[model samples]
Target: MRSEPLRFFAWNLGLPLAIALAIFAVFDLTSLDEIISNWLYYPNHEFPFGHNRLFENLTHRWPRIIPDLTGEAAIIGSILSFIWPLMKPGKHDRLLRLLEALRIAPLLRFTARYRRDFLFIVVSFAVITGMIHFFKSHTSIYCPVETTLYGGTMEKKEWFENFSLFHEAGPGRCWPGGHASGGFTMVALYFVARRHQWRHARAILYASTLLGAIYGTTRVLQGWHFMSHTFWAGVIVWISALLTALAFYGWRRLASPAVQAPGSAPPAPEQALSGLG
Candidate 1:
């Protein structure tokens, strides 16, 4: 049997995923999407109408801000962290020299042990974001603002109903909340947390989830997406990160020797060598 920590980790990662799938299975999110979008949306006005009024304008466009901070900015920071050790600071200025030693040097040492894991995390982020964009382009789903519901031209669509991969519904390209994926991609931190200092990792995971949800909400407010789009984006990102972590950890586990019981006979050399042949 696996250890208790492993069991707990699996449960922690799994329960929400199960809930997400169940929600998608049983509920049609169109009506709720309309309700939320209508609440914030003002269809009649120009420049800043509907959900866009609050999220995109009144809040100084936090939808863009949050994703930039959490998504691209975070990824860039991770890359820099991984490479901080390789950076050769010139003896140019007292301020620059002091900053490099006090900040960059410590960060470099701290991140050195996790360099491989950091690379994996970055790759996972790229894959998840790339998948989101691919689906967004191919799914051919329109945004709420573009739909008739919010006074646009195209027909509104329920999740996965009458959907096609190649069909082009209209100019609307708002399926799966690409912006929300930016926030959801932060789940990479959760994968990193699995290795050590799990409490901190849990905190990071929660923070990332919350930020992603909030970012999705902002888009909904702008009538840019249905709630289902954002919800699916989060689920996709979580699942992607989970699979990535499992792939890495499972490979390591399989490569290591299994623990044997006391007085257990060692495997026959021929039997052990059989697979190689």
Candidate 2:
């Protein structure tokens, strides 16, 4: 099989991006946002926060912890990628000890070992967060908590409807569910496992996707975002990571002649093209 960046991009990023767009379109046309929001919210104009608002309180607390945990994880991955070669740790050193305490030592070790692959993971987190924030800042789409149905100020605007290119009211920072981006950023983990362990990569990819969905669902229940908002966040993150991985492989192929040669086999493959094909 040949190393083809366009083919890789089409399968890994283009298709998933199209799916995400379709999802956003379907939810917009069907008014599923309002429907789902209504189902989760009680007649009292409040979320079903459980007895005496236990769930509401819990959901509220998530905003505080989720960003720090996920952002710090991404930052750590990037930092470790840059510093892995410089720092050497013993079998049971403090860095590993700390990672073990956080239950992410295996991920840290894996990223350190496959440093190049992990670069895409780091890039994915940055790109996903940046794009989500850009939309959240520019788009005037209000969150469910801000909509009239939930007893807030603004009317519930569809994904592509509200906001002007020149001047628009910034209702609040509430589009695309930035909190959920944290979970979806785990899509980078998929790239780390994709090369040598295709099966494991599939499992990791699905698990990361599911984790993002669950995180987004939590935001939906809390009225901070609609289901579609979180869905798009996951989609964007996945696509960003996929494209970054494609770029990585493209660069590897260019840098190493053996990987690109028609009849030559490299020590480590520049790509595993069967899946992309």
Candidate 3:
């Protein structure tokens, strides 16, 4: 019973990771990445998304700030929650009072854990951003624009060529599209909301993935990333969110926190484990 979170972690972690790896494998083993990028680029014409005002303003520049700011804001919010327990609306507050009446005490109770929730969010964002950048630093994978397919210097290797971490010195370190990662980082917010069984949780997850896809697609259109790179970024973001949630609350409680024993002093998984030890 106590180990249900471990099971939840395995399923959530395995399923998404397998799907992401499958997506990358499809792109890596086939010419689909080149096929899609080919439609976007020609030796005669440049990758046009770079110059497009709509994409530049909306997707490229503006979105880059969102995850960074969100992480910082959540960190600050969590810290403030320590000083101000009223950061979230109380169960007795106007709108929540109605839920209290309707016996939706779970909502009321979970909302009080805003501090813990915010910690999960910021940590997930950190993991996504940090892991993405770490990969970007170590890998020398070229963007479509840098490859010869689009009138660049480097010979475009077959999509199936060994391209994972070529630590050798080169200008291109564009694996795992960074810009797309910013949008995908919002997935953590969805996980936190879902963990607490909040209303609109599904909407939050859908919106987050859509936003990431939009960001990643814009980069693909611009030749800054292969579809696989963006897919890999999604892998990083989703895994980070899931692992962080599991770390904070464990997989079982994340799946069905309502089943937690009443009067249990430890709300966090590690603390509970520590006491048991």
Candidate 4:
């Protein structure tokens, strides 16, 4: 069978392939072992622990939840990608328009008009920063546990010898992955925007949740973070989502003047498309 040139090249050597090589090179040259050992074993000082045990326990369970969720998302995304082209042309166009509305321009404008959405972003940033500070202050407490769970007890020089294939860059430090938080935040926004459409809203909610879970799981498996970190990240994201929803709804009522009732379907596809033009 004939193959498209771009597809053939991408199949053989793509951006991911190049990135993988660069990562391997960095791993070989850096004294990652020494860094991990010093960070995990050598305690510089002591600090009060603030992390809740119950929360940590819940976070730890995140590792178990991610794989199943990720598998389902993968299956769904695959099906969507395959079937999208086979959809009616009009349906496909509508889908495209829906996605276009999600572009940065609209999102930014929406956030600008709504102080609450902006506030939510600020709060999420503050929360993330606070978590980082906590990690630094209580470094001695968490690092040891992180090392024992994710990093094996090996000499600095032999660290790579026992390295797991799943290990990704930034292991130990990149715990409570930002990626998972970002994914969940997107999910929340989708939920608020499409709440009236039961089936569609549920699909998006499930997909977004799956994405967040998968991202967190991958980080843990790669030894980039502990299960606890990912869990807290998800919690923070959920909080951010609630704030974002409030901001959006409040702003819509204030800015538009006309308070349209909730649960209204969006304009018809042709009307929406014409409005866009």
Candidate 5:
């Protein structure tokens, strides 16, 4: 039997547990006085770049790369968001069926065919969860600095003062916006799944990219993360996806069997080989 303890743990707990534990460990190891001094009084030690300036530039600039569209463009984006999934019906439908089967159908079929894919999905979810937790913890810890630098005072927003809202608001975390990470990861997955030019490929890719960009912008606009944090979050996610893909699929593809030569007969079935000889 395959030992999938890590996969099982990720499936059940997700990445947040790991992140939360790590944060707790950090807090325990470092003194509260030191943490406060490093973050607020002497921000230079915690984050070298001025947080406010970095955010202002990105909030003003990054949107221009894709052009901030008005009425019709916005409607088009909304329409595409709804329509893209319908364009490629196979995988999503299969996933739904698998879920249904888990609830109502037999277990054997699900395990036989969908186990690996399910493991991949679970791992993806775990990674996203971990990214979200990490972002939230880091952002909440640094919000005072960010608010002071950008809003010009410590008493700027109620949201900044309340850490619980980070979980309540959802996706308010400072670093790698979960939406951005998940959206881009979906794009990468789509790129791998459909090597050909499928109907939904272009639409899904464009929509996901847009969603990621919007998420990054929202994080900056909402004062949760600075421009540099958002930018680096994106960098971290891209690197993670690249590394995961290379480790899992890329290596496997390289080791897979080559295609048979044209017009050549396939190898005889093992059951028939002994009789034939």
Candidate 6:
């Protein structure tokens, strides 16, 4: 209700960050990771579920297309916004008459209206995925399957133990789950809806969270990653979305004026976030 930046940071970044820190700290002290990994693994230390056709198609393979299609669609819309007119029949050349032939005036109109939000979704997804990839490459933490617990060579190490000056012989790029992060990027839709003041924005946010959890869970079951890996991936996506939103749309948007309820008295001067200055 008051101080939008504070609220934004608390919900969008702070909470997930705090949970990640907790998982990071606590997971090191417990066998929770191995416990879950062991349950999913077979007696022969094999992870057959990781290679199952059902999981591969439903979880690993199909969900990936969402972000790819979303980014591609956003790019196409942005390009059309620039040339849809010339690309139409009336004022256009032969090759440029794609829009008219396709009869996408409705889509073009929506794109024109929410051009910024759509573009921001692409940017936010790119930034989140990029950051996750960078960290995954750098962290060098072994995934469950890659560990001795699941029949690999690398010894399980603690959080601090993994932070050595040099990585071991087989360094892992599995700490922040890549596929899970991709699933989490659905939150970008919430940002777009929020920018347009859509009433179902919160529903979008909740559903995206659930979708990310499902995505991350599949990876965990498959032994491709630990739970913390997926947990941190979501945190990274959420925080990246917040920063990207602020970067694409200013912090003032985060600090937009509070909505007044019917028959409610006017708010005090301090009710808002001071407009993020």
Whole-model lDDT per candidate:
0.63, 0.64, 0.71, 0.43, 0.43, 0.71
Least well predicted 10-residue stretch by lDDT in candidate 3: 268-277
Local error of candidate 1 at residue 94 (angstroms): 19
lDDT of 2: 0.64
List, residue by residue over 72-160, the lDDT tens digit for candidate 3.
Answer: 88877666544323323544267545555886444324333466777777777778778877777666578888877786888655323
**Tens digits of per-residue lDDT for model 6, 1-277:** 5676687777767788888789877775788877877877866567657778986898888888887898888888766544333333444555434544777644654455455666787788789888886676566777787778787888776545554334332357787778888878989887766665667988988888888888888888888888877788888888888889878766655556234365654222232112112
Model 6, position 145, has a per-residue lDDT of 73
TM-scores of the candidates are 0.67, 0.69, 0.75, 0.35, 0.39, 0.79
TM-score of 2: 0.69
Error of 4 at 69 (Å): 22
lDDT string for model 1 (1-277, tens) is 4565566555756676786877676546436666666666655442133434444563335545654564554455556554444444353356446655777545543344345465667678778977776676666778877877667888876646645566544444677888788878877777666554354866888888887887777667566777778788888888777777666554233223233356654322223222111
Model 2 ranges with Cα > 4 A deviation: 1-7, 50-113, 163-171, 251-277
Order of all candidates by lDDT, from best down to worst? Answer: 6, 3, 2, 1, 4, 5
In TM-score terms, which candidate is top?
A: 6
Q: After superposition, which runs of candidate 1 have C-alpha atoms over 4 Å from their true positions?
A: 2-14, 38-105, 162-171, 251-277
lDDT of 3 at 29: 76
Candidate 5, residues 1-277, lDDT tens digits: the string is: 2445455335323453554455445533344423433444453333333356765466444543432232234334333332222322354667546545676222322222223333443354356456656656644444434545444344323223444634543333444344345444544444334332344656865675565666554554444544333444444554454445444445333223233356544222222222211
* Tens-digit per-residue lDDT, 71-115, candidate 4: 344344333333222334465777556656776333322322332
- Tens digits of per-residue lDDT for model 2, 1-277: 3657566656776788798879867886887777888887867668754334666556545544654565566666656644333334554467656766987655544445455654555566677777777777677677887778787878777656664555544755677777677777776766655544444767877877776787778878778888888887877777666667667655333223122235443221112211121
Q: Superposing every Cα of model 1 onto the true structure, what RMSD results?
A: 10.1
**Candidate 6 residue pairs in backbone clash:** none
Angstrom error of the Cα, residue 187, model 5: value is 3.3
Q: Which is better, 1 or 6, measured by TM-score?
A: 6
Model 4: lDDT equals 0.43
Model 4 ranges with Cα > 4 A deviation: 1-175, 195-199, 250-277
